[model samples]
Every structure is written in C-alpha cells, then in structure tokens.
Target: MRGITLALDAMGGDFGPDVIVPAALQALRYYPQLELLLVGKPAAITNYLVKYNSISNDRISIVPTKYIINSEAKPSQAILSSQGTSMRVALELIKVGRAHACVSAGNTGALMGLAKLVLTPIAGIHRPALMVILPHQNNGKTVVLDIGANIKCNAMMLVQFAIIGEVIAKQIIGVVNVPRVALLNIGAENTKGFGNIHQAAKILSNISSINYIGYLEANELLTGKTDIIVCEGFVGNVTLKTMEGVIRFFLSLIKSSDDSVQHNFSMNTNIVCNFSYMNPDKYNGAYLVGLCGTVIKSHGAANQQAFTTAITQAVKAVERQISKKIASRLAECWITTE
Candidate 1:
C-alpha cells in the first residue's frame, strides 16, 4: 500500500494546536510511511512544532485556517455557516482527495454533520455511525457502534450498522474468521429490546455471510461473547459512558483500600497497568463508519496521548482501505438506501 496522508484539525480540541502538533509529530516519528497536514493558524502550529523540536519538514506540513469550531457550536451552525473552521477545512482536504483521511478531536455533533455533508455516506448508507473499540475478556477487543451518531434508527439502518461493524472487525480489528455478531438488548432473549432490534435480528439471522449470534445484554458486552455489538446511538452512548465510569470507580477503590504500603503500591501499580486496557485514551478515535472517505472523531477532551492514538487509528483505517472495503461490501449486499 502507498503511504497514508492524514489531515488534522489542529485547533478543535480543548487544548488546541499546542496539544495536536506534538501528537502529530509523535505519529510522524512512529510511522515513517505517514505524513500529516495540520490545519490551523500557521503561526500557532509552527510555534508548537518548533517547541516540540520536530523539524521533520518532509513528513509534516501546515494548512492555515482562520476560524475554529468551538466545543459548544451546534451541528447546524457548523454545517451551514462555519465554512472556514479548521474542522471543516480538514474534512475538505479529504473531500477533494487531497488527504487519505482526517482526524479531529472536535465536537461530535459538528463533526458528524460536517462529515456527512462534505464526505457524504457510502452509496447505500443513509447515515454514518460512530464506532469504538472496547477491551474484551482475555485481553481481546470488540467493536461497538452507533455510540452517538443517530439517536433514532429503523430496522434496516440497524442491519446496515451490522454490516459496517462487521467490515470494521474483519479489516481493522483483524478478526481472522467470521466475527460473531450480536444486537445489544435488555435481555439475551429474542423478545427483548424494541421491535426494531427484533427485526434487525431476523435480518441478520437470514444473512448467511455473518456469524449472527443473536441478542447480547449490556453486562455481557465486554465478556468477549461476541465480536460486534449493535445498538442505537442513545443506548450505545449510555453503555459506553457507564462502562468508563464503572472501571474508573473500581480502579480508584482498589487503590484506596487499607493495606501495607509496599503491597498497596505494587497492587495499585498492577491494577493501573491491567485496567489501562479500559482507558478511553487508548481508543480515543471513533470512526464515523459508512462515509465515502475516512473520518475519525477523537474525544473533545482528549489529551495529547489520546489524540495521538486517534491519529494512529486514522492512519490504520486508511491503510486497511476501510472506506473502499465498506463500499464494496455494501454493493455486494445491495441494500437500498433512499
């Protein structure tokens, strides 16, 4: 595969270009086959680049943009009025085929809205959904989707999500054989969730290609029982946040327990290392799946390390030809979207 070029919205996150530039430098140093286009005020990004002592002039360049989409900006405002924002500019680079992928630690709604408008969806896809990788049992991982893309979805949309999720697991997650797929529901029975999930399940079961494994409850999400979990944005977002909160709570509680100083220190360190798998920073980038081009949305509050991981995710997705693969799969399935 050819080298991957990624565009970044340098001023999108809470820390702005100061944090983004360093991360870009780190990614460049790590992946010799990667190049970056930093979209923000040229002077600001240059200052950070020099401060970080990153003089890899050949691998990194800057694209200046005057406006920035603030965290509080609405999706409609971003889509209709914020043409000059760094986030929009980064995406435009991909829309015009100047970059292989774009990564931004920006407002999710604004990112999603602008991405659909600028990059558009895959031919038969109605809307793109945000998907994140989660640590599964036995040091494995799983892909969960619609973490906050479309709050309301019909049965067909859910089925479409399954297809996108399956493609991701196969290509990006490196699932060797068929990935076991399941729909997230209140219970493991066929009669749980709403009618839409039931309908989606029926559709999945009839499809001979995927290893459809029926319903999965929230508790079994990280148990590695299934490789992909599908749900509407509202439920998936709740499930994701709840898991993050719970993991942090347990880690904190484990550290505070009364014990000998040496033992406590050792145990705390081990727990922190082991539970690092649950850290959202490790999986900071969530892809807006089913788009015509690659677009990754990092958490708005992502730190430098987290944002760098997001950039890495974008590079890997581009290398895997995720967008092209998803389009080919969808065309083969021939699911009509109007």
Candidate 2:
C-alpha cells in the first residue's frame, strides 16, 4: 500500500480507452498510493485525465505505444512479430524495473505467450499454467488450475499442476497446511479415468506434493470438500464454460421473475447467485503461474469492474510474493539450473 505504480495497457480490452481510462480513475480511489503510467495513445489519454480536475497530470503519465492487440490476432504474431502493442510494452516495463506488475484485458493467448517469452519463468519451471478461483456450492471458493495453457499434459505435468494448485490455494485462498485436491474426471473412483489422469493420480499419490482427494466429476467442482481441482485445459475449458452457461441460465430466470414470484422468492435464495450473475470475462481472469513476474490475463471483452479487479489481483500477487513461494515449491521438486 506504499507507492506502487502499475503499468496498464490503455488501448487493450474491447471498449478501448473508454473502459481503461475510467477504470484507472476508479482504482485510484481504492488504492490511494497507486500511481499509473498509461501505456497507449497520448491525445486520448490526456483528454480523459483532463476531465478529473482533482487529480494532477504528472501522476497520470502516458507511455506512447501504437497498435492494439486484437482478440482475433494470433498470439504468436502479436508477441513475436510485432513489438508495438501495449501488452508487450507493459511486460517490458516489468523487465526493466520501470513497473512492478502488468495488467491487460487483451488477448488471453497473447498475454500468456508474452508472459513466458518476456518475463520468462523461474529457474526450475518448464511452462506456466493458468489458474482461477470459482465459487463452491458448499461455501467459499475452489481453485481451478490449467484453465487453457496446455491442452495436453503428461502425468508429471498434471502432478505439477496439483503442487502448483496447492501453493496458489495457500497464497490466494488462504488455505493453510494441505488443501484437499481432486482430479477432474468422468467419475470419482481412481478406476474411472485414463491417460494423464490415471497416471497423474499415481504420481500425485507418491510425490506427497498435495492433499490428493482422488478424482472428482464436473458436478463436484463446487461441492465444498475439494479445495483445488487439476486437469488438462481441454477438460478444464469445458467445465469452466459449463459453469458459465449455468450461471447465465439462472440470471435470465432472476431477471424474468414476475412480481408474484419475486414476492415468494428471496434475493438471497441461491448460494452463488450473485457470483453466478458475473460475466465469464469478469470472473474468468487467470494468473500465469511459474513466471518470474506477476502476469494476469482478463478476457478481451472484460468490463470496467473486471479490469479493476485484475489490478487488485496484481497487487496481491506482488505483495504476497507468490513468485517466491512458487519458486520454493518448484525447487523442492525440480533441480535448479541457476
């Protein structure tokens, strides 16, 4: 909460400067010590800052960068072929010590790709995986790892996800000791799954990396007992989408409810009713774990609130020293080159 200056991609996101400018102003109120170096068009950014008479111009500096990285743009082309995009510039800020963290509501694939290429990974990391928190049916929330980083993984990779998931749970979710973990599968029993999952269970069991609670069906994600769920991106993406669709279905029901039904039904009826109303992009931001610096990805179509939360998420990541914790956990397993 001291003096943490964040580098934000002003032209990123669907709404462009319209969403980014206002959200930056909103974050200032919550984080008084927050300093922003807007990375995008100068004329537009200056005009937006001029609207706020209470804030000084120097605090809202603009770092010029041309071109916006579209959601449709290939991740490789944006990261490798072009260097003028705001997303790449933000990461460069972290690399050169100009900023502490980078937050972008840009292309998820480009963000993930650039994070690995620019920020690089810790000494012992092979690749970075994406993780996010979802509300559980029992109460609190559950951590889902490998949202869509890698579609295919080996037994060792899945086991790594379990250990990585456990570390994230301890840091962000505040689950101390060993958190109960489950592998996403067709059934609960160990005999139900195949490929990396079956092999993963054995690897996880022997490594003693986390509190393995065995396999969990998609329905069990928010069931409360499990603290973390690990699986490949193909399965994880499907599960996430299904949960999103379910949330949308209930939201429509709530909106269309008649006065008679409204009188009979309380607003607090469903457990995750409020959370369920959230947009997929709003609750869909993921952190690329195993990186040297804090790298977070929000949906390209994200709204203002989600963009602000991504900044808050970045703050927590840096303050908690998540990179250090992950490094420690990785070193315990893999041999360090540095």
Candidate 3:
C-alpha cells in the first residue's frame, strides 16, 4: 500500500493545473498510502503545487510533458500528433509500472485511444468500457458500464461487460455475495431488446457463477433491483446524460420557484440536497475497465471536489488490484482473447 502511486494528467482538464493541483493535494490528505505523479508543463504545475503546498512534498512528483490534446480533438488526431501530451505521458507511466494507475480529465476519446495504445486490453477483453457507480434508491450504488466507450456491442461483448461490472461491484462496492446482474433493455420481457441483448441474456442465465437476474429496463435503473447493468455505449451514454440533465433542470426549477412554493415544500429542499450528492461529480471517476492497466477518466469540467473523488477512485482501483482480479475472473470463465 505504501508503494501505491497514481499518475495524474494535471494539464488535461478544463481548469488545467489550477484545479488539479489543489485536488491532488487534497486527495493526498485523505489517502495516506497514495503518491502522485503530476504530468504537465513543469513550471505551470509547480506554481500551483507550491501555492497549495501539501504536508508531505515527498508524496508528489512532476513529469513534464510537451503538449495537450484539445478538448475537441478526435482520437485519430490525438494518436497522430499528441504523443507528448499530458494524458499520454500519464498513461505511459502506468504502462511502465512507474505508477499503479492513471487519472485524467482530458479529451475522453483521445484518452481512451491513447490508453489502449499504451496499455493494451486485458487478455479476454474486446474493448474497454467506461464504468461508474451511481447512487441507487436502496442506498447502494449500482455499477453501470459502456457509458461511452464502444458505441455498439455484440452478445459476447455484453457478457464481457458483465464480468467486468461484476468484478467491480464485488471488489470496489463490497457486495457481500453474488451481485445480481442484468442486461439493460427497452423492457424486461425476454423478446424486448435487440438480438444481441437477447443472446447476452441467455448466456448470463446459463453461467452458474453469475447471479443473472434477467433483463432490466431503464426505468428500474435507480431502484437498486440490480447490482450491475450492462448496455452498449450509445444507449448507456444517452441514459447517463439524460439523468444529468433532468437533475440539473429540476434543481434549477426548485431554486427559481417563488418563496411560497419554497416554504410549503421545504422537505423537498432536503431532497434537492440529496440530489446534489447524487450528482455525477461525486462519482466523477469512471474507469476504462478492461484495459491492462488501471485508467480512470474524470469529467473535463469537474471542480476541485469532483476531481478529488476521481483521485480517490483511482487509489481504490490500485489498492484492490482491479485489473488483476478481472483477468483472473475471465480465465475462470474460460474466455479467451483469441
């Protein structure tokens, strides 16, 4: 645990080192075992680091990189021209084992591409999925995957997502027994979703190791009826963004209402606060699960608190050895990369 190190792309986010440097120092206070490798232009990162000086300077180090991938950059552009970017340099540190994991709030597509290029995929993984824990009504968090990585997936890929999702639920979320896994469909009926999802359901049911609970629809997502939900990237991404929009819209409405309305339903104020807790920022770190090394993607516009949460997630992934656990589970399932 003492050797746990995480490489962070300080220059990647919307706020750049100004926000990231403070967040990194804040995270170091909470995670005693954590060390940070801040990747960016030396002077820019150093100025902030010095200003928000950590209690233990020894836990923090800098790896100066030469360029940045624009927020709008495509994966092809990043692959061709941004080799020296902070995101690439941070991931390279993980590839070489200089760090156990890497966290970035850069261009999502670019980070995903660079991560795959540098770290490769886990032996049985076809492609990595972006996964995060969302607060469920049952006071537990549900693991959702493929939030925006691979737009489309086959039955086998959905099964692979299940395996990764299950491992995460058990290892990180601390589910005591078999986690109830389900495929997210348009409806819960057997014939409701696409052929690939139907195929995935059949595969899940027959696998004795997985506590497959059949199909779950989007409406039941936050009910905590399922421990893990597997869906293709396009669907998952849309669902996630929709939830964010709804929450924001309601919060805005509540705040703008007249004083009479605000006073009559003051209890709703508490609910509003809870909704704030449920914001995506609190769960800001999403792993590109299925990568050979641990790589977390944070929201590019995340504030200091949100960025701190992402750093905490990266440390947890390293501490739990998530990548190793997933590889072992895949082997047990007799899933092969070839």
TM-score per candidate, in order? 0.95, 0.90, 0.94
- Model 1 RMSD in Å is 2.4
Worst 10 residues of 2 by lDDT: 268-277
What are the root-mean-square deviations of the candidates from the true structure over C-alphas? Answer: 2.4, 3.1, 2.4
Query: Candidate 3 overall Cα lDDT vs. reference?
Result: 0.89
Looking at model 2, how many pairs of residues clash? 1
Clashing residue pairs in candidate 2 are: 137-222
Give the Å error, residue 14, model 2.
0.9
Q: Candidate 1's C-alpha lDDT?
A: 0.87
Give the number of colliding residue pairs in candidate 1. Answer: 0
- Enumerate residue pairs that collide in model 1: none
lDDT of 2 by residue, 267-310 (tens): 63553455553546555557888888887776667787878777
* Candidate lDDT (C-alpha), each: 0.87, 0.77, 0.89
- What would the per-residue lDDT of candidate 3 be over residues 248-316, giving only the tens digit for each residue? 787777677735475657677777777776777788898899988999999999999999999999988
The segments of candidate 3 whose C-alpha lies over 4 angstroms from its true place after superposition are: 54-56, 257-269, 335-338
When summed lDDT is taken over every stretch of 10 residues in candidate 1, the lowest stretch is 255-264
